[model samples]
Target: MSYFWTGEGGVPGDFAYGKIHLFAVAALIVVTVLMCIVGKRLSAKNKRNVILVAAVISLGFEIFWRGVWIGRGVPVLETWPLYPCNLAGVLVPLIVFTNNKTLKEIFYVFAFIGGIITFVYPDGIFVNSVLNFSILKSILQHTAIIFIPVFEYFTGQFKPQFKKLWLAIIGLFIHLFNSEYLPRYFGMEGDYIFLRSGLPFVIPGVPQVLILGPIAIIVMFVFYAALDRKGSKAALRRKKQ
Candidate 1:
């Protein structure tokens, strides 16, 4: 049992890869539906704002980190062959219960617990220790970012602050800095950092540490700015009640 639990066969990626038929994602779908419906019933615009921010951030992180960096060869199919977990697990619940501060707190609490369980437990559930840190970091990081804006949206606590350029720039810097120590310490490949190969113009070869680092920050800022703009609009709409 331990062998089946800890060995290669025990991990989620090993089992779930390409096997589009699974129950977990379905469970996420069900949770999404319930949360959205219930959340709407108890709704406040502020709560909706929280969820909206969460949804956008969730999508941004997934797209930039998961889809672009790792799944390089795969085409960005917007709709089908769907990977729905992030939307379901993170966004839907966030939007639904953003008004309920307790619920939001619970979600983050459990999210942190889930992160640890998924990574450290090694009990045949999931793998990818390399990517896991970033994923988990995003979860924690975005929890803080998404919460204030979202809470404000529903509560009419403040006006929507639209600083796309700064938001994007900060996001880019944060991600670059986040990646710096992890890859080196873990001895993992820095394939996601851009143009060690593939897209040459984006990140050139030089003092890789210095060169790629700033470029990565710039690229991330561009990507995040777009996402932040969308979120700000959504929050404003929710704020107007």
Candidate 2:
């Protein structure tokens, strides 16, 4: 139990597919669906407020978690918010509060992909027991990452723009640069975005993190295209009436 609160325990070993992982994923799906339904039912003003609250809570936890790591003597560089998921944590509040359409579009695609992948195949934070604070926090944080943008889409607050794919790519470049160069310059060993080596489950000789951005963008484009095609068919049907 002290290990849960205190970061005194050694870092847990690599994640293996397990029952807890499945339960966490299932819970995320349920929460996401419920949020979408409630968001759709809410008045526009209230929906925005809901989003604001979610963003605040998500960012707050992220900062708190980092503080815990730092207090426990973890290096600041290693825990910097440079990973795609951590970057999303910072961006969510900006998107929700400022209502920046461009940022929202950029965050939506990246968050959706990153959140899904992280939840599905978690690392470092995964625990055999659900009672662990790390596991609970991981589940909640990733859920927010997946849910907020999806809720926005359901409420018509966001529209997919394939051109914004460039924004995600740019964000990736910034992370990669920091992960690669900052450590060498500072004489510290840090793997911010895991650019040097992929996640635990990744096969050898594959640049998983490097390739993930382009793959995510392509997937988003295909999803947008399918939605557009469906909308076109509906419009044609209505026009024929």
Candidate 3:
């Protein structure tokens, strides 16, 4: 139990990209593809239910994890609203339910790209930890971030316009500002964006942290190529109408 919550007797990076990690990603991709195959056929009620269930799970795990962190005596500045995944877990639900197209333009990218990166690499966190509460919570929460937006797209709910790319850039500016200044204001040492801190996931000589901005921009477009979205806007509009 202590291993589950407190991580008292666990090894770090135990499952990073091992079989379990690959299996998990494969499972999610399979489910996402299944959803894509039958998304348009699903009823509105069922779609809403699916979204609601995922949102609750993501938000619930985030709260639980935060409680664990606080209970374990981790600093608040370092834990809450600090990282991209943190926001993706905590805020993405609110953005979606509120139907905030603008925030979606920003966070949908976070939910997809940030979630994929962290979920895949998870170096210091999930990579090494045995299957405990921390690992379960981390996996579920990360899955939610990646799953929700992509699921929405699969269901014809979100049609991202490339011209709104600036919205995400501006959102990242705010994120970077908060990352650098928030901890300083609180008199705590922190690296929320992983920009100052060396990233656990790597690109060898190039600092992986520097790539986040460009990656964010690129992924806003890649959902099209990656998902094989054909006439996404027209399809989405036709569905909505």
Q: What is the C-alpha local distance difference test score of each model? A: 0.40, 0.71, 0.71
Error of 3 at 239 (Å): 30
Could you tell me the TM-score of candidate 1? 0.34
- Candidate 3 on 15-107: residue-level lDDT in tens? 677766777778888887787677668898788777877787777777778887888798765676867677778888777678778888776
lDDT by residue (tens digit), candidate 1, 1-241: 3333223332335332222212333433454455545554554664555456655665555445545434545434322112112223443345344445433322322232233333322222224322344334333433433333333433443232333344434433433443444455655555433335444344444655466556545644443334357765675688899
Candidate 2 stretches with Cα past 4 Å from truth are 7-15, 127-130, 198-217, 226-241
Clashes of each: 8, 0, 7
Better of 2 and 3 by TM-score: 3
Query: Candidate 3: lDDT of 207?
Result: 64
Error of 1 at 99 (Å): 11
Clashing pairs in 1: 45-154, 46-153, 46-154, 47-99, 49-150, 50-150, 51-95, 168-221
Query: Which should have the higher lDDT, number 2 or number 3?
Result: 3
| Global Cα lDDT for candidate 2 | 0.71
